[model samples]
Target: MRGETRTVWPAARRVAGGLALLGAATVGYGVYERDAYTLTRREVPILAPGAAPLRLLHLSDLHVTPGQTRKFDWLGELGRLVPDLVAMTGDVLSHQDSSAPLRRALAPLYAFPGVFIPGNNDYYVPKPRSPHHYFKRHPGGPHKGPALDWDGFAKDLVADSGWRDMTHVHDVLTIGGRRLDVRGVDDARSRRDRVALVAGPPEPGADVVLGLSHTPEPRVLDAFTADGVQLTLSGHTHGGQIRLPFVGALVTNCGLDPSRARGLSRWSAAGPDGAQRMSWLHVSAGLGTSPYAPIRLGCRPEATLLTLVPAR
Candidate 1:
């Protein structure tokens, strides 16, 4: 009996030690994932014939807080990519005091032409909630946190940086010698999007027609697809922030599927003549997590550099 008991005690000790090691590793990994900044590059063949390739940098969901030097450094480094255009899909702030740091970080990219649309977080700050709640469907209710100064945010990002504000409006621009017809709406998650304002087919003779929004809400995508927009870009889901390996995002928080929470996919809708039209969609995984829940797992915070090549 003594011999048997001694053997069992040793085995139990080993098991306890292993469990403690695993727990420590998990916590360390969570910390690492939160600060891991990754850059993703994708080649999208969506340009018209005879058009030159356009290099576009897509940025979103910075969730910038004061004194986050790593994130600020990463933003400044992005300028080295020298993209033809920059598209920012909001959630650019988290704390009221973050504006100055955010602007300084983005100063390098101001040299390039860019467009921006506001997200829900841009208009209102985020409040703390249970991390587990992120995996469930978002409950619609009154927003938390104090109201943000969206006008000032826009002035710094749009006016000071010389970037275009595409909120509920359409514009035509000549980018890299190709004509682009771009239209965008405010965030649909906050019910701020007025899709009717810019709902129409692409302008004639436009080399490329693109749509931009903060959330990849289906209704807005449907409207853009119906209007013959060839491509749409957005961010807001954060690629679930804590995805699983192979399983991917747990919840998109919007109409988009979990599989497409972060990357490119095709969006289709029925036209007036009962014909189906398809458009390319790109949803950025984004750069930062909500300040309250700062840890990430399999999903690394990211910004995407997309090369737009001519389609066959």
Candidate 2:
């Protein structure tokens, strides 16, 4: 009996030690993943026939905090890509004091045309919460935090940058010789999106109609698709921030399906003729995490370069 007990005790200790090591390794990996900035490039064929290809840089969910020099340096270098257009879906700042650094980081990209919309984090500051909250749908209610001065942030960003504020408004721009009818909404997570303000068919003679929003809510995507918007871009899901192998994103945090939380997918809506119309959807995994939950797993912080080629 004594010999058996000693063997069992050793086996138990080994099992416990192994679990402890695994937990430590996981936490370490999460920390490493936070700073693992990656650039993802994808070729999307969505242009009209005979139109020249356009290079688009999709940036989102920066959640910038002061003193993240590495991230700022990385962002400052993105202009070297020389994208024809830049689309920033929000959460640019996590703290009110982060605006200066955020602007500095984005300064290089000002040379190109860009457009932006605000996310929940942009309007409200982030408060520390359990990381587990990300894995589940946010309980519906008002988020608690000090409000941010989004207007000032927008003003600063647009001062030298050609980026347009597309929240609750529609505008047309000529880029790469194509007339882009761009429409956007403010963050829907906070119920700030006034979709009706910009809801309608694309302006006649526009080459392409695109929709932008911070959260990839199904209702917004539906409205955009119904109005002939051929493509939509969004962020806010963070690709579940911590994904699992094989299973992928654990939660989208919005109406979007978990499978479509990141990367490009197809959204279909019934057209005026009752025919099914499909729109291309691109949801960026995004570039930064909330300062409180400063970790990532399986999903790396990313900025995407989308080459909009002529459809075959």
Top candidate when judged by TM-score against the true structure: 2
Query: Model 1: runs farther than 4 Å from truth?
Result: 1-20, 141-143
What are the clashing pairs of model 2?
A: none
| TM-score for candidate 1, residues paired by index | 0.93
Where is model 2 more than 4 Å wrong at Cα?
none
* RMSD of each candidate relative to the true structure: 2.2, 1.4
Write the residue-wise lDDT of candidate 2 on 1-312 in tens digits: 999999999999999999999999998999899889999999888888888778889999999989999899999889999998999999888987988888888899999999999998897788877756766676554455888899998988888686899999898888866789999999987789888898888888897788999999888888889889988999999988889898999888888899998999999988777888889999999989888878889999999999888888
lDDT per residue (tens digit) for residues 1-312 in model 1: 999999999999999999999988977897799889999999888887777789889999999989999999998999999998999998998988888889899999999999998888987788887666787677565547998888788887776798999998898878767788899999998889999999887888888888998999999999999998888999999988878887989898887888889989999999778899999999988998888887788988899999899997
Error of model 1, residue 132, in angstroms: 2.7
